[model samples]
Target: MTKPNLLPRSSDMASETSAEFSWPPLESNPEVFTEYLYQLGLPSDWFVGEVFGLDDDSLGFVPRPAVAVIVTFESLKKETDAVAAAKVDFFMKQSPKLDYACGVIACIHSVLNSLDSITLVENSILEKYYRATKTQSPADRATTLENMTEFQEVHTSYASLGQSSVPTAEDDVKHHFVTFVQNALGQLIELDGLKKGPVVVNAASSDILKDTAAVIQARIEAGVYSDSLAVLTLAKVADDIDAAVQALIDSSNGVLEVTSVENKDGAKVSRIKCTATGHEMPPRADIVTAHVNSKRFKKATEWYSYDFAQFEPYIVSHRRKPKCLFCNVTGIVLNKIPSEVEKHMQGRKFVRMKEHVKFFDEAEIDKDD
Candidate 1:
């Protein structure tokens, strides 16, 4: 959806900029959107996986039983007209209650409302929000969502992360996020919070993945998205895979055979083989702890810790191209080995960064450097 029209005139810009209620613009990254779901009490494994393409092969990247797909694209003129034409009566009739962040929230609600098979933990924000508004119209639900302080707080928190070190006054009015999911009726529906209501795309299908893929592919070919640039992704609202694996180990009544599997990197990882279900999985942290505590597995190697005495204040980088957080510069190789870390620590650039971190601290260094 578009940014809220809080500052329509130049005179109002000053007041709107100072206003606390103005929705901070968020990044279009799936990670940010996924974190918003986590803040709403979803598990860590219920993640947003980005789809690189709209073809059938692209579906492989997405985890199965995907509750929703959020696609962000540069809206084309004809595509915009198509969306306006296909607007449902329910949402079209009502005025837009939800403000700028409606697209993200709408996708969240659409997934929770439609996917009953996916279990949301009891008393979760997703569960509670769904139950409280299950009977209301989509428009009414949007109205309720617009006023929720908790959601606004969570949305604002992530949006702040998208803010750059250099604040800009110009607003980019190109990218928009829209969600796609199979509604309770088994029809693939497009839920754009900016739109009046859910837009019906197709009827019930055995494979919603292929159905959704086809729809997305058509849009890409129709010039709605410049190939590969169109952001298409599937965010599954499901249980944590790690948590599920743990549950299996806890409940297994079969012979628990513990073995050390040699990983590709020559590391000996603990493997738990359960005879009951013939399932084999890597041991969870707690399971490994139990084994170590009970002396089932004894440590042979000496415990060594990296001491970055000369390193700067860098937490860690998650981006594709990692950088030195202390230096505020990119291209620093992410060498996890202690020796490599120590070597990087002794570098002149890092030493200079250490001085800056000591003087200004991490936040100020990020801002001022």
Candidate 2:
């Protein structure tokens, strides 16, 4: 079957007049923005997560210690004063060619500045932009960004909202997207595309997420969104959760290297050693158990009810030869029915296979859906 387009589609905002065109408005979704970042060559370790509502409690949904928060808020007359009164570190103003795309770029710029782990590839478009504008004035930096064709292309492509073709101009909308971040000194900064400089929210704390939310909340209460708070959407740029989990699994691979130290009377003396540190490494069995208990593992087995209906024919055709669902190698026999399969399931090989299957299944499900 031809799978449906799993990509996000933009709302009907085609231009009424043919003379002018604007970039399509992007969805304020973490997954959509995250995938776009990946398309821009961001490493898998980083992603964007959306905060559903502007409520203080809603901040808990996003990963903590987020590199930056992308906030979509209604533009108001007092916005300039509100941001100025707060602690502000404004960046360059948005270029005319990249009007709507700047907020997304500013969010990414915050991540690049705050998070050391979210590094760009060597000689990357982002790297070049960073280096070129690192010492330039905000105006110069903005000019430098406007000329970066590759970066603009990727941003525009994602901004297309999965349309096979898009209009030159989008319906003129009033809402604006801005980025909130706590700099290295622990001061909240707002980066808006429309603004000439970053707005500093006069709040400083180690927990930037909550503090930034409070700032946005304050703005909402005083600005146009005060009446309708749902207009505010937040996305956190942070390290990927799955990648962090996988790193734990990888760290468990501290080799127990054996080396012969000396020979005594033609007998060799050896010792086994592990050189890895930073955290107490779990045993292989514990790692396997963790994998089995993961959500990915549970979801992959949805198609497998263990009624043996799907496997009975395959099992019989192979003459009782049972292959591990995880390992894919067949050595265990299906001679004894469910008991044999159940017994095989406890083995490490099956556990390893389950881990692999879970990863594959999750990827397939994500891609298909």
Candidate 3:
């Protein structure tokens, strides 16, 4: 328009400046192109710089097109921070052929790799933190989660029994079954992690028969027990209880084995064996019954009551040191008592006397007072 100016326009001038600083064409030599990008602030880790020279064809014709080499470098970093820098290097290799779509796919792949690295690092951090603060064993934590989930399911299933106008024997059996299964599963999970062995659910506890059947059914669904796994029932081995054994066999597809044992009431107990073998075995129960009971009832009775007919001597020997029982105990120690030995056992501490005495006289009391 008014005799077009020979001088370049502003856009053309800007383009010339950009062209001067532009990355070298990859067709000339990919290494030169990569180095140019690196000089332009591209990260060193973005591309693999190894040179694989041209290959030979038939009759030793060395004419294989130079192939760009890519090597992976992994670093733990936030996904958002790494994507943009990764994308620039990826597109540089593809720009000569105008393979924009390929370049985009490569960038996306890099982003996914970065995200996966972050996720793995996060899980590892959580695992380390959990070990640092948690007092429970790793097996305990794993079993706790397993038990809690199972307990919640059972609790939800039994809630309807609460509102029933007439509670029947069937309901009682079901409730007992639920409790038995919950306990058994908890024990099994713990044992599974510790023993690294299969939990052989000894069906000797008649209270657990119905529950065992339900457990077997559930395990079948979870793939813990299958047709190959052994399921032994005492009923099957005994002539009088074959029907009970058959009932369980009919309920599950697992292999059945039976044995007999005497029940608490003098009746023969039917034992069903659900042996979990191999790496697939579930955990065993935490069999801390006697220890747990001792801890639970320790503080309920005074020092005299603790020196029972069976354990009196041991108690005396343990308390002779004028030890601070509470501090030594597995439980929290509140105060130090010079005479009685206080120690934590299974989250509870107990104070037991060094020697039994009928009474504290006025002189002893007066000295302390």
What's every prediction's RMSD, in angstroms? 16.0, 17.2, 31.3
| Strongest candidate by lDDT | 1
Candidate 2 error regions (>4 Å): 1-24, 80-90, 115-117, 162-167, 226-369
251 in model 2: Cα distance from truth in Å?
29
Ranking by TM-score: 1, 2, 3
* Per-residue lDDT of candidate 1, residues 1-369 (tens digit): 998743122222223223344455456655566666667766544456555555665555355666666666676644553542233222311223334454466446444644554556556666555555555676656655555555566766787664463122345546666667765567777776666567778876456667777877787778776453434344443233355345544653334555566643365565676442234444443323333334222221111123333344453533453222222332365543445565666778777765655345588878986
lDDT of each: 0.52, 0.51, 0.27
lDDT of 2: 0.51
Clashes found in each candidate (C-alpha, N, C closer than 3 A): 1, 13, 26
Location of the lowest summed lDDT over 10 successive residues in candidate 1: 296-305
Q: For each candidate, what TM-score against the reference?
A: 0.53, 0.53, 0.13
lDDT score, candidate 1: 0.52
Model 3, position 208, has a per-residue lDDT of 30
TM-score of 2: 0.53
The digit string of per-residue lDDT tens for model 3 on 166-207 reads 333233221100011112222211011112222334323333
Candidate 1: segments with Cα more than 4 A from true spot = 1-20, 80-99, 162-170, 228-369
Tens digits of per-residue lDDT, candidate 2, 83-179, equal 4533333366666755765555555555555545466655665655665666677676666555555655666677766444543446564556777
